[model samples]
Target: MADLSIDFCGIKSPNPFWLASAPPTDKAYNVVRAFEAGWGGVVWKTLGEDPPAVNVSSRYSAHYGKNREVIGFNNIELITDRSLEINLREITQVKKDWPDRAMIVSLMLPCEEAPWAAILPLVEATGADGIELNFGCPHGMPERGMGAAVGQVPEYVQMVTAWCKKHTRLPVIVKLTPNITDVRHPARAALAGGADAVSLINTVNSITHLDLDRMVAYPIVGEASTHGGYCGSAVKPIALNMVAEIARDPMTASLPISGIGGIGNWRDAAEFIALGAGCVQVCTAAMLHGFRIVEEMKDGLSRWMDTQGYADIAAFSRKAVRNTTDWKYLDMNYQVIAHIDQDKCIKCGKCYVACEDTSHQAIARAVDEAGTRRFEVIREECVGCNLCEITCPVDSCITMVPQESGKPYMNWTQDPRNPRAEPAPAAAVVEQAGA
Candidate 1:
């Protein structure tokens, strides 16, 4: 079996799965339960200074699928509503009990250095492994100029990270906000400020749904509502893109990433690791299911790794980063055409409808002698868009088979059709030699 253990920025864990800083890790009870259920670590819910954050009533809403399955979750909830002393005491005892499990405390405070200076020693005294700077909370905390407000600005991210680095010896992991235009800027800022690692993406600002009768948004409070943080399986693509952006950036490439957002299973976790996350953080998954979900996550990841001949997490980590690239670099000469398996076709006409109506009229419909409908792909007209494959209900019924285009590898940048295309390498070399 492949080793699942990871040393994320010097914090060792038996496995790569850690509960994110949310309601799930808000207190000792939840953390202990998660540990007992096989979670390798937990980032205790974000804590503030004395006089804890006041949370609102009806703090959650959900966006559901056709069968009413939760696709996304929204929350207006603030940071830990529990007092500082109680949280600290519980964290101290919990760490003492589960000595092996990673116990990273999440902290949010005013952008001032004094507040950070005062709180660092208290948290470090609790024997927590490290601290995660909660700069990504999008809703309630931002109104106080603490969470996303600070994260949205690169300067503030650097300033507060530097303050924490100055005040504490513990490793600082800056949790980044996804609400920004570009995630790499904040990641670079964290690196510049001396952060050991960075975690993302904090929830996206969203309004899940609205009530038709009352004309109010979801999780309504007295016929009124506001935008909250959106998370869950729906946000995985967004999170993956951000993680890849930071991973591929030259300045922040070496910074460790703790991938968060919409990770619900082993496959999801594996994708994040392949994109260069040192470890992964779970919240909505554990909330919707239970801590026991980690069992399947660990087992599935381990089994898959074994099949791939990977000896450890590092063997496959960041393996996909190099393959991810700009569209301009893609091979325009590479071609593929959809082939429908006659034995497996259900004759649903979904593929034909999808291709003929929205995409290219690549699929042809015919009626046989027996008056049966048949669909076939016109080889010449097919652009290999995969619309037919995507609309097909049956798996493996339509496969896109690559064709030999008989052309050397060429990208858009070197194509003659492009008005601004760069000269071919041979031409450029000849021009340079003549010059």
Candidate 2:
């Protein structure tokens, strides 16, 4: 069997799957159940100083597909609402009871040094594994001079991270917000501040939709609604790109990553791990399908590892990082054309309509030798854009086949079409005999 255990930023867990700081990890009740369900760890819901924050009613908005599956979820909910002492007492007892499981407390406070200094010792006394600086909540927290408000500023990120590192012995994983223009700046700042690791991406600022009749957005409280933190499967691509950026950056290449956002299964966890995440966190998935989902995550990942001959998580972690590269570095000589399988086609005409109206008229109606009406690819006009494949309702009916082109590798940096490209050797182009 493959070992699912991981030691992330000096915090050891039975597996890499941990619950991100959210309602799922808000209290001891949820945390205890999650642990019982086989979760390796939980980042306790974000803790602030003395008095807890109050939340509003109907603090959720969701984007759904035609099938009514939630494609994206948004939330305006704030952090822990209970008192500080109560949270601390619960955290301390929970950690003591579940000593084998990793317990990292998430914390957010003012920009000054005093509040952070005051909270670090209290959290450390809980016997928790580490602390995660909650710099990414994009909703109500920002208005209070916390959350994304602090994350968007790199200097503050560095300063606050430094303060936590100075005051606490526990390893610090800085949770980052995705609301900023350049994610790398704050990542580098976290590294500069001596952060042990970084977790991302915090929810995005989004308004689900406008209620046409009411002239208000969804998750409306009374007669109004506000933009909340956006998450769920839709944010996976954005989160993956951000994680890859930090992982592949020379400045923060060695920085430990705890991937968060849109992770719903073991495949998602493997993707993050392959892209250089030492561990992965979950929130939306757990919220959508209770904590038991971790069972599949743990089993599926282990089975996948066993099949791939990976003895442990480290065996294949960051395996794909080297392959992720810039668009400028992509080969320009390689070419592919779309091929349609007539036998599997349902005659929906969706692909043909899409190609004829919106795409390059690459697909057309044809009559086969068997007197069957079918859609065929126009090789001469085809651009291999994959738009037809994307529009096709029938899976595997449209495929992109690579053409035989024995041309030498060439990239944008040396392409003749690039006017600003540096002068270099002319690309070797082996043309097809008859086009």
Candidate 3:
């Protein structure tokens, strides 16, 4: 089997799958159970100095998909409500008991160097693997000048990261918020301040639902509600893009990334690693399904890596970064036309209806020799948009076939369609003139 272990900025875990800092890691009981269930590590839920933030009733709201599967989850819950000294004691004991598992502590403190400085040494004494700066909580914590408040400000992100680095010898992973305008700025700021690694993305600011009858929002507390941090499958794309941006950025390219947000399965984890994450963290999936989900994730990822002949996580990590590029760098001359397989086609005219009515009139119905009507593509009018393929119910029944255009390489930056493009060669001009 392929090795699943990773050393993320010197915090080595048995595998790359760690429970993100959330309710799942809120206490030693939960952390020990999660470790017993085979998770490689856990980022103990966000801890702070002195009195902990109190959470209210109905702290969570969720969006459901078809068949009532939870697709997205939002929460107004604050950091651990227990006292700081109790949390530290439990963290220290948990580390002692599960000495092999990675135990990184998550922390959110007032945006002062003093509070951060005070907590770092205390957490380091716990024998934990590392600490993650929780600058990404989108709701309650932000209102208190912490969490997203600090994360949204690049200067604060830099300054606080510096304080943590100054106060602790442990690896510092700055958790970034997705609520910001440009996530890269804060990511760059984390690197500028000597952060050992960066993790993202924290939850997105969102309102999951509203109760129309009551004229109030979901997770309605006393008939009132506030926006909460949103996480789960819905946020995966956003997380992937942000991770890729930082991974590809020249300034932060070498900085280790801990990918978080909407990682539900092995494929999701694989995609994150391919995009340049040194490891991946999960919360919602484990929260919904339980800690046992990590077993499937591990088995599936290991089997896949073995099949691909990868020796370890590093062999394929960041493999896809090279293919990610700006729109201007895309090939404009590449062409593909959709082809429909008559044998596999159930004669469902859904594709024809979609193409002819809503999209390009690229398909038409015609009678075959047996007098049975069949839909055929009008190649001349086809734009190769793939709308027909997407609308087809049968999988692989409609496939995009590459067309031999005999055109040389051209991108948006070099295409004649772009007014700023350089003058075309005489041969190209003659060819266009003949057409």
Quick one: best lDDT, which candidate?
Answer: 1
Is 1 or 3 the stronger prediction by lDDT?
1
Ranking by TM-score: 1, 2, 3
| C-alpha TM-scores of all predictions | 0.97, 0.95, 0.94
Residue-level error in angstroms, candidate 1, position 268: 0.4
Candidate 1: regions farther than 4 A off: 424-435
Ranked by lDDT, top first:
1, 2, 3
lDDT of 3 by residue, 1-435 (tens): 899988899998899999999999999999999999999999999998777888999999999999989999999999999888999999999999988899999999998889888888999999999999999998888878999999999999999999999999999999999997888999999999999999999999999889999998888899799999899999999999999989887788899999998999999999999998999999999999999999999999999999999999999999988778776666688888889999998887999999989988999988779978798889988889999999899999999999999987676656878989765464554333222
Give the per-residue lDDT digits (tens) of candidate 2, residues 1-435: 999998998999999999999999988999999999999999999999867999899888899988889899999999999899999999999999999899999999999999999989999998999999999998898898999999999999999999999999999999999999989999999999999999999999999998999999989999999999999999999999999989888899999999998999999999999998999999999998999999999999999999999999999998888778777667788889999887889888899899999989988888779977789999989988999999898889999999978987777877889998855554332111100
Candidate 1 — worst ten consecutive residues by lDDT sum? 426-435
Task: Output the worst ten-in-a-row residue range by lDDT, candidate 3.
Answer: 426-435
* Backbone atom clashes (below 3 Å) for every candidate: 0, 0, 0
**Candidate 2 TM-score, C-alpha based:** 0.95
What is the model-wide C-alpha lDDT for candidate 1?
0.94
Estimate the lDDT of model 2: 0.92
Off by over 4 Å in 2: 367-372, 423-435
Against the unseen true structure, what C-alpha lDDT does each candidate score?
0.94, 0.92, 0.91
